[model samples]
Target: MTTSFLPQSPPAAEVRTAAGGHRTTVLIGTDTYPPDVNGAAYFTARLARGLVRRGVRVHVVCASPDGRPHTAERDGVVEHRLRSVPSLVHDSVRLALPVGVRGHLDRIMERLRPDTVHIQNHFLVGRMLAAAARARGVPVVATNHFMPENLFDYVHVPGPLRPHAARLAWRDLGAVLSRVDHVTTPTPAAARLLWEQGFARPVEPVSCGIDLARFRPVEGGDAQRGRIRARLGIPDRTTVVFVGRLDEEKRADELIRAVARTGADVQLVLAGHGAYRGRLEELAAAEGVADRVVFLGFVSHEDLPDVYRSADLFAIAGIAELQSIATLEAMASGLPVVAADAMALPHLVEEGGNGFLYRPGSARELAARVDEVVADGARRRAMGARSREMARAHRLEDSLARFERIYREVAAEGAAVPAGGFTAGR
Candidate 1:
């Protein structure tokens, strides 16, 4: 028997009362979760916690690092861990097909009889679980987290062949989404993309909220900033920080190129790591700006806020982010943002107001904006102040409440009404 860690459990009375006087069992399916550094994992963890706090019983079914079936309870939630393949990277893992595990999941579902099912990915496992839930009369709600374009970098196909493959992926995605009662997306842009790709269900915009209290701006003088910068070996000068995975999709190379064009005395700090780390380092050297660049791989969560506070501006060049949690965290830390005006970034970055935006893929345009933010101290401070205000409106409590409501609605709608029941408005 595997040891279970129950950090804290809600009172039985509270769980009974808020579950609408009925015990609610919500099954959340995902391929990835905690111990994997990604937006999807963070959002899943937060959403599950929120539901549990609201007197709902959540059962998370996800793939484990090792290929085996296991069970555990964490943070007032029950986890059903299945086996998977080990990832190429030391700190990562991937899900795999195992007959034993598949049978185990089926048996668990038979026993639980959950009221509602929620899936977060469009992979094979997600589809299987979603189909299983629907067959059992449980409402399934799937959230689209990955964009089809993300596959282009993995497979080497002709340009014309790429769009065809994307279409096929979307078709498969639509097949799974069509079976669900509703779909949720982190941004309106994402929801529209899903609708355009033939997901006919209601696509709700439920964003992943940030922790305001944990990311608030520092109030002291320059002492905190100076200490952090000095500790990180960042000189006492203007610093632009990029905090995310150092990969092609993140466009860290574009930031290096833009920083090379700027004449101002600014230091570029790249945090996080991935397969593209060496390439980014080489790009910095090729651009003749290696000396001004500092690459810190895999920054811990505890030190992230301090790193954001130490920077004069936060820069990101990616156009694929759904909500850009890092961007929101930067804004909450009182730093003006400079990001490409593509994807959902424009929704977060109000040009010439809270932050600045440049045309995507244009290093020159990004460079110009970076220069503008770095050159004016007063404008930077004003933009940072406005950014913090905007961040406040999207707090964790508010966003989680919206998700709880959606979960309850799906559960109630999925529940069967008695035969010859009184019709509404009769």
Candidate 2:
């Protein structure tokens, strides 16, 4: 039996109630958070920190980085981490046991009384929290960061049973999310995907924007690049970088094969960690490009901009990205992208304009596209410039402002309702 370190209530400064004044408080619920490297985790952390910067009180409920329950504060946002267990699927992943979770969540909601509850996914944490918030008459805003394909390999689901599993997952998501006040996804394509999967509801598309100011082109030139390269232990060669989880749906094996097929003095740098790392390393050796591939596992948030600066081009073979945040960061860093022509990648990669998109899972096609840009210096620079220009549309400030508006709108509507989100006082 695990001891409960769950706090009855946070410090006064951490959460302010309506009696204290009219400060908008948002409770963000997610199954993952920082120290758990993934797009959803990174986006949720950024959203919380961004809201705090905008003078809104923020609270995040997520699984503990370890198996212990605790409360901690960072970036002016309070984090309520619940007890979790090691996942049988992946080493870096953890599963929160839902048994007796609602009691803790109810205590949290009663103390915080958040104006709006923002759920990042319809998983264990998100689903339960949304239900708890709803029972207390709080408005809930849910974002879909889920893809069945992304989890198939992690859960060891059989190939033949994947379609059936996917349908069940989508139905479960719809049933949970439909109870929320609003639903959003990272891209229009993602929203359409939900609709196609039998979810009949209004789904808005919101870009998981990037911090353009932080991830701009390197100004220190070769000196800075050389320093970053040396620090990362990367060889001085024409580099193609990929940043994200090296997971199954990431299709990093295709990249290894593509690197081998390039048949040039080029290197592929994969700057993230996942369960698929071992397989990727093995694939690189099998393709005879072991020496040409560099694995920089779990790049720090502070050093990631420089990692982008160290590359000539960015490549993503990921087939299930709702909106690839790493791809946006690379574009913001003025690097031409070579992405697989799948999912929402086309939204970011404008073929022959900002970058090129090759047939997904085709190493020869990906190799050709990468070579086309690397071989032509003038074209490469032009594409990089276009990438930067295109990235400006998905600014972090804009996304934050949009979400703030949604929170205010929903909170206002919730206020007009009676206690328990019912009709009127009985």
Candidate 3:
């Protein structure tokens, strides 16, 4: 069972309330946004849209897509893009300059008077947003989606300085998050880790929600299978689909070798991109499964449902996941999963039920588990039924409702920055 810290809001502070049951205005802050494509970006965009649909006005503060404030809008939600420079190391990720960030946020909050502020990270933009919002007497709710390892995956730092770097990162994170009324992570494992690292503030576990309607089994799923075969050029073959960034930590190369070890006539379809893709291709060629493996980088969101529906089974080789959104999506599509036994993945894949959890880094074990599922039609369908059942608890509406309640409680509690400003914890 998971544990959560009760929200500890500041006492005797005024909160911005909706005017006589009018639409509440919400300001969401994040470093990443849509068209960038990552777990954090996708969830933030959806959250904003969900709030907007429920008769709320949402304003998003995120990195500028083109270094200009053309400002993106979706279904009555508006994104205020700040100036950003694309990372030289990571072409897809951009860092918004912090210069005048707090000033701009202060002005925005003062003018808009949003009822609550939700931030998605502790980086430059998010950090500034929390402080500015608190200063303006708005309740703040922050969600952390990355560990230090995940951050360094995209931004390089010296190997020897990592320990000190981690400490520094934690200090910065602690200081900023301390100011927020509440904090959330995607899973219990993640919440526990933060608490162990001296993040004494309130922490809650919220799943990264998936669109259950689109991802679930469609028309007995037979109609989707034929098209998948034609799209990937693999007719009458067992297919294991892995959808996520092809980064080193994701261990896509290891999955390929594991499939090769199985010695089954199975095809591996990878749907996502990262800096490590070249290395993955090289590894595939060396493993002699190059012909069977397909790298379909950056699959469109519209086509993602089909990709999941067409697969016979899904696999997650990565161990660093707090909660695998891809695993949930596959489960929703009525596909059994084979995930690495590490981090929070074990919480989702019940042994001998929906799928098996192989020891992390054990390619042979992973292959054996995956082959077991794909080898039998009856067994596969039974496991897939369990997967669908598991996915129901994580429906998008459930997560959205949880967040909605959090926002309302914090706002009603009237939490605000103390008179002397936030005090940093030791």
Arranged by lDDT, best first: 2, 3, 1
Q: After superposition, how far is residue 407 of candidate 3 from its true place, in Å?
A: 1.1
Superposition-based RMSD of candidate 1 using all C-alpha atoms, in angstroms: 6.1
lDDT of 1 by residue, 1-426 (tens): 111111124444444336347756789888777655567776888778767876778998888756676888887789888877765432453674555655666777899998888898867567778867866777877788887665465444568887778777777777677677777888898887776666655689877787777787767747778888887667777889988776567888889999898878888998777767899888898999999898877566567777788898899998888888889888888889999888888878888998789988888888889899878889888999999998887786788678767777988787332122111221
lDDT of each candidate versus the true structure: 0.76, 0.84, 0.79
lDDT of 2 by residue, 1-426 (tens): 111111122234643233346668899999887666678888888888877776789999988878899999986789998999987766766777787789999999999989899999888999999889978889999999999998898888998999889878877887787788888999999998887776766789998888887889877866777777988788878899988777788888998999999855789999887777899999988888999999988665567788899998999998898999889999999999999898999999888998999999899999999999999888988999999999999998799889988998898887222221111111
Candidate 3 worst ten-residue window by lDDT:
1-10
Model 2 TM-score, all chains together: 0.91
Task: Please list the residue runs of candidate 3 whose C-alpha ends up more than 4 Å from where it truly belongs after superposition.
Answer: 1-20, 158-160, 221-224, 231-235, 417-426
Give the distance in Å from residue 323's predicted Cα in candidate 2 to where it truly belongs.
0.5
Q: What TM-score goes with each of the models? A: 0.89, 0.91, 0.90
lDDT-superior candidate, 2 or 3: 2
Best by lDDT: 2
lDDT of 3 by residue, 286-372 (tens): 988898788877666567777777688999988778888889889998989999888889888889999999988889999999889
